[model samples]
Target chain A: QKEVEQDPGPLSVPEGAIVSLNCTYSNSAFQYFMWYRQYSRKGPELLMYTYSSGNKEDGRFTAQVDKSSKYISLFIRDSQPSDSATYLCAMKFNYGQNFVFGPGTRLSVLP
Target chain B: DAGVTQSPTHLIKTRGQQVTLRCSPKSGHDTVSWYQQALGQGPQFIFQYYEEEERQRGNFPDRFSGHQFPNYSSELNVNALLLGDSALYLCASSEYGIHTDTQYFGPGTRLTVL
Candidate 1:
């Protein structure tokens, strides 16, 4: 099985809608979970970062990690057209080592 | 200060050829790591360089090699590249080592193997 699994979603939603992106991992050793946003032809940018099993909120984005189930999620409230991009979930052990990445979910927020 | 910067924003090369991509880490940063991102896929770790020495490597073969200069600049060299080597090469810089450091990424160089 892949270390990290994420649905490659081209999920489309109207502006102002709430968006939920999720990823699951098989490795329980992963302690640092991160969400990255990537636009077309661009490099992935750090969006949200969380350690262990907890929730971290940054402005309109919230990252939740559940170590018990090895599940992670990124919730975007009040989505905007500019929010359209690929959302990737990455995870690593304590000090970042071989960060495994998910396939990324493609999201499009229409105006 | 400038963020991570990559040179040759885009390039096209034929199979069996060699290519070198460059990256300059963010100002005052020390560690540099490289990743390969294919179309519609997330970036995969290639390797990392710290203190001008190879620190960690991914599943990639020996054909994929890198070097870190004294100034914290880096170069990723692919020898005898294959068509599968076509991907976006990314460079991420961090202030400290990979452990417990937040990585800042460059714009990345898009490579096309023809």
Candidate 2:
């Protein structure tokens, strides 16, 4: 099994809606969790970052991690058309250097 | 400030041919990491370079190699490339020794192996 799993969602929602994207990992040792946004033909941009299990908020984006369940999520409030992109979850062990990224979920917020 | 920059924005090569891609890190950043992103997938870590040496590597094969120059610029070389090697190659830079460092990525080089 792949260490990390995420729904390859082409999820579409209207503007002003709330969006939730999630990922699950098999490794219990992962301590650093991150969410990245990637537009078509562009590199992944770091959106939210969290250490261990907790929630971190930046603007309209909120990242939540549940270490016990090995599940993580990113919530986008008042989603906009500009928010349409692929969201990726990445994690790493505390002592490890490499970050493993999940197969991203594609989102499209329409007007 | 200019962000990370990669050369040869797009490339096409035949299977078994070699390819070299280049990257210059962001200003004040000393560490560089390379990633491969295939179609419909997220980027996968290839390796990282710091202090002119490879600091970490992922599960890539020996055919993939890299170099870091004194200026902190880096090169990724793939020898005897296979069709599977075709993917978007990204270069990310971050400061070493900074706790919980965030990587800044460049517009990746799109590599296509025929």
Clashes of each: 1, 0
Real interface contacts reproduced by model 2, as a fraction: 0.63
What TM-score does structure 2 among the candidates reach?
0.97
Task: Kindly list the per-residue Cα lDDT of model 2 for residues B1-114, writing each as its tens digit.
Answer: 999999989999999999999999999999999999999998999999999999999999999999999999999999998999989999999888666777888999999999
Worst 10 residues of 2 chain A by lDDT: A91-100
The residue pairs found clashing in candidate 2 are none
**Fnat of model 1, as a fraction:** 0.76
Error of 2 at A87 (Å): 0.6
Give TM-score values for chain A, per-prediction.
0.97, 0.97
DockQ values, each candidate:
0.70, 0.66
The single-chain TM-score for chain B of candidate 2 is 0.98
Score residue B61 of candidate 2 by CA lDDT. 95
Model 2 chain B: which ten-residue window has the lowest total lDDT?
B95-104
For B1-114, candidate 1 gives per-residue lDDT tens digits of 999999999999999999999999999899899999999988999999989999999999999999999999999999898999999999999866445687888999999999
